[model samples]
Each structure stands twice: as structure tokens, then as C-alpha cells.
Target: MLSKYPGAVFRGALSGAARRAIPASFLSLRIALPLAMAFSLGLSLAVHQEACAQTDDEQTVKAIFDERLTSGEMYYLLEDLCKNIGPRLSGSEGAERAVTWAKEVMEGYGFDRVYLQEVMVPHWERGNPEQVRIVDVEGGMIALNALAIGGSVPTAPAGITAPVVVVHSIEEVEELGREAVEGKIVFYNRAFDQTVIGTGAGYGGAVTQRFAGPSQAAKFGAVGVVIRSVASNFDDAPHTGGLSYLEDVERIPAAALGFQSADRLVEVLEVQPDARLYMHLSSKWHPDALSHNVIGEIRGSERPDEIILVGGHLDSWDVAEGAHDDGAGTVHSIGVLRTFQKLGIRPRHTIRAVLFMNEENGLRGGLKYAEAAKESGEKHLIALESDAGGFSPRGFGASVDDDVLERFRSWLPLFPQNTISYVNKGGGGADIGPLRRETGTPTIGYIPDSQRAFDYHHAPTDVFETVNRRELELGGASIATLIYLIDKYGLRDEKAQ
Candidate 1:
């Protein structure tokens, strides 16, 4: 059995003069600055770098990255998907069409196998356009731009016209008490902090309101909820994401305000006390509809029994082409698999690229994949999820045994040439989290330079136009390299190969 250690250590290797030695390409305007910053991050993990034999594995991975950077196919593939089949929200005709598109793609690329796993997903349609009318104290009604947040129930007949109660933080609502919250429209004005170099950090700070504000505010007898769009850009587009209601909490109408509208509303409220608003939404959840998880594979020659899975959700919010949010992720996952075949590199374990369904509104796709893995008693040696926006490769974050983690750390030296430094202990993407739990697999999430992801995340602007070509290919190469390494030398010695 492979030794699995619990103690964690980080080994960050860098010389004092690391800066000057890096080449001009390493000093890319798009990549170098982030790499230099990543270099300073002290990692105390210990690893036997000497033990990482200058093996064929290292050579193959380097070649993979080179190909990805120079001649990667993800660029053109994404063009067709985004320009052709844009905005594939799950259970919608677009999502269903995407499944067929993926199947044809796999076959056209000459994959050994291509298939789909049936997934029944919730279909929540955003009906007619939502209306937000600002009733001024001077008696003039101004219509504000808005959209119903995904998974939110539309307002009733004649809609809700209540005094808008704006709060900067959830704690502010608590401070104001139930007396102030009752029968009012709750507007969560928390914006994504842009100062953080890694925008994911900022998103981490403010996403709570978008995900849970409604149920929490409903507890205070709020009539409706309007969360500031979870975005870093200043625009008039309302972003949408998943929302859940706590058991027994009253379900009220919810929506998101564009950053500009949120700011304007704040300004108007300062001058005109007792600002009122009428919100009219017509969104609802219907019965489950058909969806599928698109699966394609490259069978191994040596140890076919072991499995390495790579994936991205095939669903997006129903606005712009879901390119960056996950369409880029899905294409990159497929791009990794396709690159292996194109490069003529056969693996030692079965490598699968799964395009998961319903990741936007529900986690049903992830849950089902894990459930099948558990019930079938199949061993998931390693699983990689690329739900993060397709940006330049930063490093890999993982949830694995300490010994396995130590082994992963040993491989960092190979990726330094590509400037991917961080390889820390972490969880996989939401779509693969359940699989990690059910199978106890060594799960990994692709970490790109999260510098610009939040600006477009879950928003209409999260389209192909926002996706950087070089960055997308870089991300694909990183994932392909990780997949190659894990598949070749198995994640653990104890796993049957």
C-alpha cells in the first residue's frame, strides 16, 4: 500500500536572484508579473525533488505544454462553440444541443469512445423581462434596468412596490433589526473588492449574498430581495447565479441589480429619503427536463483499470455565450484529451473528459457522477475539475493524502518553466466535489491566474470575447500535463493498475 501521511509541509524552492535569470518570454505582460508574485509565496512543504527521476514523464509533460502554447487546438474549438452554440443553460434546448455538439466533436476528433450519461435537471425559465420602477419622493417613476436572478421566483401579479432598504453588509441588516426589514425590498450592496490581485479572493468575500441573502432576509419578513450583481465591472447587466431557500423560510422574489444601478440607487437614496420601488418578475421553476453529461475517453495501454477524470460543467446562466464561466472550462477539458491524441501520447490509465450538466442552477450533474462512481465500486484514482475561468495557468490546488500531496509537490519543478508555482492542498470544483467525497479520490482543481475571472464570472460579459486565446491554451496545457502525469504514474502505489 502507498504510504499516506497526515502531516503537511510546503517546500517552496527559489533562489534569491530568481528574478533576473528568468527569460523574456517568462516575463510576459500576461504571465510574468503573476509568476514573480507567486515566486514570493513561501511554501513550507517538504519533498524529495531528487526522487522525481528525470523520467519520460517529465519530458512528455514539457512537450505537452510546448504544444499547448504554440499549436493548441482549444482556440478554434472554442470559437465554434461560442460563436455557434452560445449560452447552454442546462435543460434548455441550447444545453441539449451542446450534448450533441460534444458527441460529434469527440467522434470527429477520433476519440476511442464517446457517450452521454442521462441527467434530469431542473428547468427554471426567466420569463418576460423583469421591471424595477423607482418611485421618487417627488412622485416621478423611473424604470430601472434589471433581470430576475436565476432560480428566483418572479413577483406576484401587479408585482412588489415596497420601500427599498439598502444595506452594505448582512450584519447591517442584523443591526437594523426585524422592525426595519419587514415588508421592504432588501438590496444587498456588497460589491466584489477589486484591490485583490487574485479576483477569486474578492469573489470569495461577497458571494454569500447572491447565494443565500434571500432566505436569510426572508427570515426577517422581507418582501423581496435584490442583491448587487456579483461582478467586478461597472455595467448595467444584472448577473444571475444559484440560490437556495432554507427549509420553512418564506420564498420571496429575488433579483440582482447592475453595479451602476446599485450605485445610482445608493446615490438617490441619500438625497431622497424613503425611496420606494416596484419590482415585477416572471420567473419560475418547472418540472425536470432532459440533460446529459458528455463523456469522452482515451483508453490506457498499461494500467487501464485506474482512472483519471477531467471536467467542466456544460451549463451556464442564460445570457451571453457561457464561454468563460464554463464553456471555456469544458472546451479546455476536451482540449486536453484531444491534445493527447493529436500529440500521439498514449497513457497508462483511462483518461476521461466529462462535460457535466446543470452546474449553474443545481449540482445534480456532479451528484450523479459521484453516485455512479460510488455505486459501481469503481476506483477514481484522480479527478481534475476545470470550473475556474480559462486563464493562464497558475498552479494546481488539491485534496489528497499528504504522501500523495508530497509526490505532487515533487512535480512542481517540471512546471516552473511554465511558471505554474502554487500546488497547495485544496478541494476540487463544485461539480467534482461529490465525486471526491464518495470515492475518496485525490481531487484537484485547475487554478489559473484569477486576475480577471471575477469581472466576467456569472455575468453576461462572461462570453467568448472575454476569453483570452493564449490564456485558454495555457490552461488547457496545464491540465493536460497534470492528467498525463497522474495517468502515467498512478496517484498511489496501492491502487490497482
Candidate 2:
């Protein structure tokens, strides 16, 4: 075996002066043997120490899982949030209640501190269930399952009936021009590409229609806008998300048709080219309302100034319990804190858990927190977010330097293969995006298997029971482990410094 010397200089080569001083016979195996033995001994000692450290880390991670699986409260916490609080859209009574509940729960856990940061959030209400139907159809008026996109302006009090025009994308809508789309209800029919391995990518690819379809339609003088649900599965449940109305154009009513409803509409439109849709949306927008981001933390024994953050959005859509959308993530953050306290694992860096508000309609809470964090002048080691649904752990997506990302990948052996197997590049959730941008701090997103996540996302079917107890607890455990590892070690890349 080759010896690794301190200055990266090997043993075989010798200076000309030294070579002459030492006898040629003495410079042979007789002298080389002792040096080789010394190097071997030193290497063995270093290997032994490294092995011991790894074993300790492995044991700690295993304990975290065991504690969560055997006696975790994440599931029950989720139940209370979903069943008791129901929906918690920003600026709603439910959101207020959730902020209070989150603060109290963390306080009850005996955290070092529990507090709230005020933020002004957008307030939009779906005053009544949307009414969307096809007029003069073969089977009379055919009602389609739909929900108003959050922040959408209401239609006329009596509603508007106009001929329907179908378009697959924003470019397509532009191609049709005003003449083809004027006084019509524009339908954006873009489906999720199931062939994509990451379901979130599919949702990402299709969600553009929902977010911008309204303004694009309004640009063409369309009376209203409808879009195929950006969902992975075909179902009657209609998903709802926020829409943006460009200031340059008029605001128009926008809603999402359930996957099944969109399919039915498409079939009917094929047979009856001049079909018209009557859409009535009573969704109202109020002035910005007061809200807060909930925070709790455990002070570090060492490095108290450097902070490590773990969080999820506290708000959800108004249509359902909002369990999988983010209720699962909320409990996961709390559960991590509870685990550390219960296990008596005092961290090296301050660990803070934040429940961000206004993730559904706006990111006021996230932006507020990032601004506050900057004002406070605290050093943030990293921020981790779990907004993906509670499912079996897949891995983490980290937005960090390439070298730091590789360093993270090196730690994967410490995790269970099934739970957390990879750490890919380029990911930090919406709520944590501002933090990464504001401070240049590394951000991580806890990724759970999302094959079924879109099934309940923003839909009424996203309730507490849809989450599995084992899967939810396991997710918490996985997050706790990652935080522990980062705290024990650190993010200071030696090469960068």
C-alpha cells in the first residue's frame, strides 16, 4: 500500500544531498520497512476513529426513527389540524386559529422560545360553490365540477354565457387572436405527463395554465377562463390554486374543471363545436389582512448564533381539510422539535421551526420571515422545508454549490436506503425560496414519494385520513436525522473558504 504523507509528498523520492549523505545500502528495504510500518499504524488509527464516529451517527439516526415509529405524535397533531381546524386559507378564521394552535403546541413542548412574526396577507374568499355548466347540450344543462381559482374576480352577478374556445397553451391562445376568442370562455386543457418520473414536474409543467390562463384569456377579451385540473389522476375532485391577473389586462373569472369534468367537456365540444358555457363565480377579494408566521426553537449548547431552520406552510386552500397539501408538513416540523426534546439531544446549532402562512395564495409570510431574519442579523446555517405530502421518504433536494451537494451525497450511507437514498441538486420549496435568495444560505426540501401527492393536492379529498400514520412518522424521522447531521457537522465547505 502507498503511504499518504502530510504534504502529499511520497516517501520514495529523496533529495540529492540526502541521498549522498545516507549510505546507498541503508536507503534500501531495511530503512523503508520501518517507515512503511509507521504509516500503516497511523492509517489504522485514523480509520478506527472514523469508523467509530460513523457508528455513533448511525445509532443516533436509528434512535430517531425508533422513537418516532413507537411513540410519535405527528399523526395525532395532523388530525387536530385537519379535523378540528379544517381549511386554513390565509386571512381566514381557520388560519388565525392555526397560528394560535401552532404557537401553543410548541410552547407546550417547552421550546426555548415561541413567537409570531406579523405579515399582511391577501384575503380572497370563495363565497359560494362555483356554478359552471354547458348550455343547450344534448342532455340539457350539464353541470361540471369546478372551483374558482384563488384570487379570481367574481363574474357578473347573474353570470355570463359565452361560446367556449379550447386552447392547450398560452402561445396557442395568442395564435387565435382577439377575433376568435372575443366574448368567449377560454378553456386551457393541458394534462399532466404521467411519463415523467417526478410527479411534481408533471404538476409544474401543467400548472402554468392555471396560474396564467386567466390573464391570457382576459388579454383576448374572453369573458371567463377554465382549465383542465392539473392533476395526475383522473377523478371528479376539482383542484384549486392561485391565479395571477396581469395589471395590463382586465381581470376575468377563472376556475379549474375536475379531470373527469374536463374530459366530458372535451367530448361534448368535439361533437358540438359551438357549445357555450355559463360560469358564475362569487369569489370576492377583500383588503389585505393581518396574519403571522409561527416560530419555535431550541437554543444550541454550542454555536448558539448559527441557526438551522425547519418548516412547512401553515395555510391551505379553503375547499378541504388540507391534510396532505401541508398539514402533514406542519406536524413534521413540530415533530422534529418534539423528538429532539424527548430524546434529550441537545444540538450544536440553534434549531428553529417555523410555520409559514400565505403559501397558498401569496408568499407574504415567507417573504416577511426572510426579511425579519435579515434584520435580526442572525447567521443561518441552512433552511429545510417539507411542503410535499406525507408519504414514504424518497430523499432531499438541495440548492447548494456543486461541492456542497457532493458532500451531502457522501452522508447518504448513514440513512436507511428505503427512507432517504439520494440528495439531488436544485430544490428549495416556495416558502423557503426567499430565505435562500435573501441570505445566500443553503436550502433543502424534504422530498417524499409524490406519485399520489397530486391526487389530493388542493382538492376536497385531501383530508386527515388520507395520510398514513407510518409514512408521516417516518417522514418526520427522516427530517430529524438530516437536521441532526447538519448541526453536528457543518456547512462550511473547506475548499470555498
Q: Using Cα atoms with residue i matched to residue i, what is each candidate's TM-score against the true structure?
A: 0.86, 0.91
Best by TM-score: 2
Candidate lDDT scores, in order, read 0.80, 0.88
User: Against the hidden true structure, what lDDT does model 2 obtain?
Assistant: 0.88
Candidate 1 C-alpha error for residue 385, in Å:
0.4
Model 1 ranges with Cα > 4 A deviation:
1-58, 416-418, 493-497
**Predicted candidate 1 versus true structure: per-residue lDDT over 1-497, tens digit per residue:** 01222111221243334445567776777886677566544221123332243435566777887787787478778878887888888778888888899889998998888999988999998888889878899778877767787888889978988998888777787888899999999999988888877777788798888778888788888999998888877888788787888889899999888888888888888898698988999887889998899999988787676778899988888876888879888888898788899789888788889999998889889989999989998776788999888888888889988867877776676673655787889868999989878878778988988777777777777778787888898788888877876765566554442
Model 2 over residues 1-497: C-alpha lDDT tens digits? 11211112122223332344555566477777875566566556555655566667778999999999988588999999999999999999999999999999999989999999999999999998899998755547999999998899999999989899999998898999999999999999988999998999899999999999999988988999999999999888999999988999999999999999999999989999888898999988889999999999999998888899999999999998989889988999988889999989999889999999999999999999888878887788899999999999989999988867876777787777699999989888899899888888789999999999999999999999899999999999999998988887676532454
Using lDDT as the measure, the top candidate is 2
Please report how far candidate 2 places residue 475 from its true position, in Å.
Answer: 1.4
RMSD of each: 11.6, 4.5
Per-residue error for 323 in candidate 2, Å, reads 1.2
